[model samples]
Target: MKAVAIQSFGSPSGLAVIDLPVPAPADGQVLIATEAIGVGGVDVLIRSGALADYGFAEGHIPGSEVAGTVTAVGDGVDTSWIGRRVWAFTGVGGGYVEQAVAPVDEVLPLPAGLSAVDAVTLGSSGVVAHFALAHAHFAPGESVLVRGAAGSIGVTTVQLAARGGAGAVAVTTSSAERGDRLRKLGATHVLDRSGEGDADAPPGYDVIVDIVAGADLPSFFARLNPNGRMVAVGMVGGPPPADFGMTMMAAFRKSMSFATFSADTVPVSDRRAVRAGQFAAAGRGELEMVVHELLPLDQAVSAHRKMDAGEVFGRIVLTP
Candidate 1:
């Protein structure tokens, strides 16, 4: 099997494609012929050696989201899953290869109406979006803000929020062009990150999905309604502000609580449920997984380059 591995952690160029022996599934696991692998920002961070503490070491096969067909099953696993099309979160690595093995319990059947490409792109992002919306405890007619609303997770979050009955979904995009795309994804209003649109923006939103954490923290918190919740998902903007203390103090006064979605912390059963629900939503046309581009497995380096440049509007997927 051919796999993309980080030979060194520095640049996208550091990722090298090499042939490796195919891995066999262990007991309770199943081997999948990977049809699509989803690229993520965490892959970029790992490739760049920025997330070393997260245990992404050199030579690590770096991908978690995959969609494929079950080719074989290991001992103690049900044979029924063989030949079934599925999508899953690998939890660690092995997604960037022609063949990967995953615990049978972690895999979910792809909905009838979803494609492998869309399923892979929705991998973890869609699961997190679903979990985030659930955590917000939103009700019909509530308004919400989605930061980084044009990116993969942002796009899914917008769709899920709207489908869950948000009356108004305000999405923040760094560029006017991206804002237009967000609007098409169901955002009732798209706010430019340039601060020009801040004057007349709604004072308080029922929930704020903060994907771009750093600088946007202040403005995001300020826009939250009393007792509102903020789910921090990404740090695209930069590191959290040094004055996070003050920000938390403000949130404290307003009775607002901050929440974060950590895939590692989510129980396997819960994660599986969320992934299944997301796929069902996609099948029903109530949620969408935006696929910005699809590249062959050999172009994995180029895919990482595009992501690092912030040039992709949605998920970049690689087909094996």
Candidate 2:
């Protein structure tokens, strides 16, 4: 198997393609012949050793989403899954390779109207957007602010918020080109880079689907309307540096709520259901799967570089 591995914790230049022997599936696992891989900021973070809290070791293969066909299955897995087109998590982070073994429970059948690439592109992202919006209890006519709205999960979050009848959909991104593209995708207002305070919302937002939790987070919290909810999904900006406690106290007077969420918190069955729904939505063209770039597996280094530079407008998929 050919996999992209980080030889050291530093820049995208450290990502190297190396050959490894494919492993057999353990009990309850299945072997997939990878077709497409989803590249994102988390992969760059793990490659740079910024997310050491996750215990990613040196030479770790960083990948979370893979869309492919099930070539084989292990004991306790049904034989019927063999030869099925699917997308799944590699359990840990081995989806960067041409072949990966993932737990059967984590994989799902590819829907009829969706391609393998679209499946992996929207698979985890669509599921997370659904779960997060559900957690925030987003309602019609509510105002929404999507932090980091140019990325994969952020794109889906923005689409869902707008389609759900949000009276206003505000987004933050570094590129004007991407911001304009986001407007066509449903963003009512686009702020450059500084997603928090740049846009004016005199009444504040009813729900904030925040993917970037940086020093600007306090500004977002303070922008929430009475009884508004802010769900932090990703910390692409590292961590919050300001005194959030003071802001939280002030927001408390307005009955605002704040929380952090991860798709892993959802039960496996529920996760599967949400993912399937997202896949079907994409198939129906009700949701947009913005595939910005498709690169060969060996270009993993360049892919990470683009993500770190914040130049890519949408999801980047890798073909193995």
Candidate 3:
């Protein structure tokens, strides 16, 4: 089988294609012949060595999500899963390959009418967005601002918030064209990447879903309404300053709160249920899955280059 691995660190060029023996399903695992692999900000971080301390290393295959057909099942697994089209979470690696193994419990059968590309695009991202909103205690009629609203997770967050009956759904993007596109998806107001231009936005948002947490993170705290909640789910723009917490203290009188959420904290059963629901909703046309581009598995480096250069607007799927 063919797989892409990090030959080095610090640049997309570090990723290289290599041939590896096809891996087999282990106990409680299932083997999948990947049709589409989702490229995300975490892949960029992994390739750049930003997560080296977290156990990623040279020659590490870096990918977390994929959609494909089940080829085989491991011990104690049902043979009925074989030949089923499904979306799977391949943990932190092995997903950048033609054949990958995932815990049987981590795979979800795709709903009718959902394609491999759409499944990988919405599977993990939708789950994260759904739980992030819940972690922020989002409620219908509450205003929402999705920072860095161009990626899959951000796009999903916007759609979910709007469908949840948000009074206003604002977003931060790099261009007006992308903003316009997001408006059609659910965003009511669009601001520049720096989060300016609130001429028509609400005075403050009741909940903020921040995917980019950098130096500017502190600035968004001021845009929160009294008793507002802000949840950071991704650090695509890099980590915030060490003292960013001081800004939250400055807004103490507003009774505002800030939190960080990760799907890892959610139980597997809950995550699977939510992902299944999202897939069903998308299949029913109640949710939209955005795909920025489709690249061949060999072009993994090029895919990461686009992500690092901030040239991608939605999820990029790698076809094997």
Candidate 4:
């Protein structure tokens, strides 16, 4: 098996590919022949040791999303799954290789008519988007806003919100090019975060799906309607604001709720259901999980570099 491993914590340049023994499935586990591996923001964080303070160790394989075929099954696993096409959220690592071993319970069948690449593109981003929107409980005909709406998760959220019957979907993007893409993805309005404009709403929005959290959060909070919900899924813009006093006070006064979508904490069953929904939406042409680029397995470092530079507009897959 060939896998990308981070022997040291630094930049994407530190990632190296090496030959390793293919892992065998333990009891209740299944081994998958990897076809596609999804590169994610969290993987870059793990590779650079940004997550080391949280106990993520170095020298670990740096992938979590996988889509492939089942090649072998361990004791207690159903033999019927041996030849099935599936996708899984590998909790730790080892997906960026020729093969991956995961608990049978963690893998889900790929929806009919969906390719491995499409399934892999959904990955954790789609699951988190589904969870966030479903948890927010936005009513049909209500207005919603999504920060970083041109990113993978943001695009997924935009499609889901539209499918759920949102009256209007406002998305924020830094560039005019991405703003156009977001509008095509179902955003009723696109706001340029870099430009001077009234980001604050008149009455406020029904929900705010914020992937960028920083000092700008106070301004985002001002756009929330009474009882509006803000779901934080990413912090691409940087850390939370130093002075969130007004934001916190306003949220409390307006009965607003704050939530975070961490796919690691979501139940496997719920994750599978979300994937199913994403696939259905894709089939209906209502959702598009764009793949900005595809690179061979050995080019993992370059893929990470592109992600780190913020050059990828959608998910980047590693073909093994």
| Top candidate, metric lDDT | 3
Q: Give the better candidate number (2 or 4) by lDDT.
A: 2
* TM accuracy, model 3: 0.99
State the lDDT at 152 in candidate 4: 79
Q: How much is 236 displaced in model 2, in angstroms?
A: 1.0
Candidate 3 local distance difference test against the native = 0.93
State the lDDT of candidate 3 residue by residue for 1-320, as single tens digits: 99999999998999999999988899999999999999988889888998899888899998999999999999999999999999999998889999999998899999899999999999889999999999999999999999999999999999999999999999999998999999999999999987787698887999999999988999999999999999999999888999998998987899999999999999999999999888889989999989999999999989999999998988999999
Tens digit of lDDT per residue, candidate 1, span 8-61?
Answer: 999899999999998888999999999999988777877888788877789999
Off by over 4 Å in 1: 194-200, 250-252
Question: What C-alpha lDDT values do all the predictions have?
Answer: 0.83, 0.87, 0.93, 0.82
Give the better candidate number (1 or 4) by TM-score.
1
Task: State TM-scores per candidate.
Answer: 0.93, 0.95, 0.99, 0.92
Q: Could you tell which candidate, 1 or 2, scores higher by lDDT?
A: 2
Misplaced by over 4 Å in model 3 are none
Expressed as tens digits, the lDDT of each residue in 1-320 for candidate 4 is 89999988988888999899998899999999989999877788788887788888877898887999999999999999999999877776778889999888889888777788888887678888888887788789888898877667887889888878898888877777887887788887778773234344334688888888866876877777788888888877666767775666845778877787777777778787777777777766667878988899999999988887877787899999
lDDT at residue 127 of model 3 (Cα atoms): 91
Top candidate by TM-score: 3
Cα miss at 234, model 1 (Å)? Answer: 1.7
Model 2, 75-141: lDDT tens per residue? 9999999999999987558889999899899999998979888987798888888899999999899
